[model samples]
Target: MSICKWIAAGTLAVVLSSGTALAQGNLDKLSSFQTTGVTEFTYVEQGGAKAEAIRKTLAGINLPDGFSIDLYAIVPDARHMAVGPQGIVTFVGTRKTEVWSVTDRDKDRAADEVKNFAPSLAKAIPNGPCFSKDGFLYIAEQNRVLVFPAAEFFYESPDVAAFNVIPQGELVPPEEESYNHTARVCKLGPDGKLYISLGQPFNVAPAEKLDKYKKWGIGGIIRVNTDGSDREVYTYGVRNSVGHDFDPETGDLWFTDNQVDGMGDDIPPGELNHQTAMGQHFGHPWFGGGDTRTNEYAGEDVPVEVVMPAVATEAHAADLGMHFYTGKMFPAKYKNAIFSAQHGSWNRTDPIGARVMVTFIDAEGNATMEPFADGWIDENGEYLGRPVDVTQLRDGSILVSDDLAGAIYRISYSAQ
Candidate 1:
């Protein structure tokens, strides 16, 4: 590669590896609505308004002055985003086993093209994609990881039928292992393995909960070799950790666990935890954060042993995607902070989360949660957009995915 190409590649790599930029959590937009010239985009739903309708961008969001939000991409069931080969923005469609690619070729910086990077298997649902050093893409679907080449083929088409590279590491623990329906793909860190977030399938289980979870493949982070070998359970007792990333500075793995339902609308806030050791458990079903559990699992010393989240969000915020900030666009204080997406809640009497949140980490590695974006949800709990994943661009600007609108918003900074 030429010198300029090398520099561009390095910059893009830094942005992708930057993790998450600081944003807001729980969708609290504290702004007055302007009734004039509000931009609105709508789509026709499949069966009816209640069916799996194609949601579009609406007017209630309150954006900061000088910062404008636009329709970035129109993807089908787009969920998560990662800066993939050639700086292309890649996202996952949960219902299918296909990895969708979004690109901005006109230099307008808006995503204008869409294609599938990899196709799905009969019963698999693609969750996330992570790139390797050798220009390979490891995608996580239902129960396995599919490796694909062409880390930089932007104009060319992707060959999903050719993926055969499997993980080469230890297998996940059989006893606690359950075939998780939604598995997230992530590049293994420090240990050089592929880490998959395996979520528990149920909210509550019987006294002998072993059979329920172990049989279904929920509640843990599993690590295996890139060649699809030597899988091992890194941790257990996790609920649904859809969004997870490793701290580039410390090599510690961090994940956002969604709070369980039926526990009252405003109880037990979702958790952000750090994996300090192997096989560590974080009080699922038995113990919870925010409000302590009164059940048999509660008042016990088990959840206590597991390190509490670096920060505690509002109850039922439904925190999903998380990334650590490693860019220079924002202030230096935000370098160690984490950016997370709060997928709006359905059960809350009034919707709570729908924007990105920032978790500030101190010099000692401690963390505190705060808001970064505050306009996706309106005052009356009306949601304008639901942020799914966060991606940092090559220029340090942050890209947020709104699955509700099938769009991506680019966030940049400029001093007045």
Candidate 2:
């Protein structure tokens, strides 16, 4: 079709789809364009208005004083990341089912080399990672854990033949209607066990079903030995916890629980929970976030002692990547802060979160959630990047992985 005719059709389509003639003017203004060099492209307005400078793919990031952030490396489908000894940053990509190992050999704190750490079938959506002292790597797929023996040699693991893959045993008991599910894994716990999160599939099932499933155990954290033994439920009432970590300071286990959706836009915000005791319920189908009841499964009374979240994030924030800031690169106030990446939300009509946030904690372990870094969610509901995970480097710098933009960012601090 001729350029003029193509422009005319585009204008008419826009007008019809918008149910008004308001879009026709903009369409006509963008009707004419030009091409320069073979690799160069440009769009020219018919009214002779100069083209504006294209916005940077990444902008609007806000960090504390003396802190700066930059794109570390370009990674396709990079989702969650784990930092290893000697500045090794490994990311698990769910879409491509590929794990990437990044390192900064030049010591600039940016990943200079990206190597394919592992590859799996399309069904394998790589979730999270934990490392053993023997250099073995533990990664979570959809519903299982795969052990990579001596994963330190990932770039040289010839033909994938040198790596060992092991699947974890199921935690749900036999005859149980519910099954094991989730995308989370924790380092071998203090008990030398690997703690895994089992997410409730449905937001809230019928009371009868809940009663039946509770008898067999469902919706909670499950733990087993590193070799996958002594399987049992650690806690219940968690809807879907995507992030978990063991505190380096207190040796306590901390996790982030995602709230159930389909609730009102601002009712039940997500949760930042700590495992106070075994068999503790953090209020799933009954009392929701902020101790507010959903009234869905009424009369199914939750225990009064059920623990509340240590802190509350934005509603439908899709929180993930709970790592405590024990590194020394930041100010004194951030020494014990818990950092989490809010992956943003799609269930809400407007976006809620898509940035890295920090929760400052005192020596007594009291915490307050506050915005540490933002600018991933825009006023117009556009997300520039979705930060999935944050990892600490040896030098105290931190790396954030954006699954949407397929990029890793390094955040560093220096006093002026």
Candidate 3:
């Protein structure tokens, strides 16, 4: 298509609306966005009634015989986490505006401080924070991408160096912004690019939005250069993926996607997808999840060759965040396995999946998933905690964030 035709096809918004983001060849002011250096940061109390209550819920959590779980920090609306490359601080993002800086200053496994990072800047749904191998931290907000150079080292101060990779109102066309399915997740790919997921706004995306979604990478994953240039859609047909990680050994991209809702109890399963090559499509409007066809486009011919999921989990369990286990603290059987969290169900008749899952991969690259932790739900079906994201610490132990409980939990294993 000619450049004129591309603009005429409703994508003029890509140029007209995204001024500083797409129009500029380079970031408007790279490494210049900084805060006011306000020292009065609001800190989450390490010891309090709330902390004890969240700790008490640990008794109901069941892990492997030699594994144990404990409260690591107190955070509000913790969604996804990024452990700093230097292993000093762990940056946790939330669906709300703040990105938390968590530190265990005493090296005691439990966090000694929980405070907001970059207090002077305004952030919208900064749900994904990832770090480069060297030190820079990149945060994926709802409609913006910001980078903080040496964030782990500078987080002790209220003001940290920041830059706009993709400026606000530019990650997606501003008009497509919605509350649902907007929490993005990002990772620095093996190719040295930043990969970010852009979710379509609706429960089941409408056909009218398909063209624009394809053009702007809505409902798909898009990757860009570290400076936010050379942006393009990397994967297609994803509904909404809040969790993704690269295979430690293979460098393949694996992600967990939430399937279409309002389908009956068990019609369409949740998805754990593996993308071996670029431009692969996972099923969306045509097939809800697995082989289940969606009601909206049942009779229509599917547009793209859809890549089936590596694992299909239970329906309505809401698979959210995941991590590829490469830690040495666990047994050899778990070396390259996948550890993921299910945030549990909302509209199901009998609630299920408020637990952590372990997926083991074989020599043939096949996957088998089983529950690694459970019992976050009560007998009356009330959720005591909802696990959002999983990440490993420098010590090789893993941390799980619970948004419902507003706390981070540390899980480790020790042979007795």
Candidate that scores best on TM-score: 3
| Tens digit per residue, CA lDDT, model 3, 1-416 | 11111212112111111112212223332255423434445566677677778878998899998899999998878889999988899999999878999999999999988878876566789999999999989999999999999898778865577788898899999898899999999999999999999988888889889999999999999999999999999999989899999999999999999998888999699999999999999988788988889999999999889999999999988898999988899988989899999999998999999899999999889999999999899999999999999999988899999998888999999998
Compared with the true structure, what per-residue lDDT tens digits does model 1 show for residues 201-277? 55644457655555333567777787776767786667788888889888888988886677787877888888878
Candidates in order, TM-scores: namely 0.77, 0.79, 0.92
Question: lDDT per residue, candidate 2, 332-361, as tens digits?
Answer: 888867888999988888888888888877
Q: lDDT of all the models against the reference?
A: 0.61, 0.64, 0.86
Candidates ranked by lDDT, best first? Answer: 3, 2, 1
Where does model 1 exceed 4 Å of error?
1-68, 119-123, 158-161, 164-185, 211-217, 294-304
Better of 1 and 3 by TM-score: 3
> lDDT value for candidate 1?
0.61
Identify the superior model by lDDT, candidate 1 or candidate 2: 2
Please identify which of the two predictions, 2 or 3, would achieve the higher TM-score against the true structure: 3
TM-score, candidate 2, is: 0.79
Query: Would you list the rank order by TM-score, best first?
Result: 3, 2, 1
Worst 10 residues of 3 by lDDT: 9-18
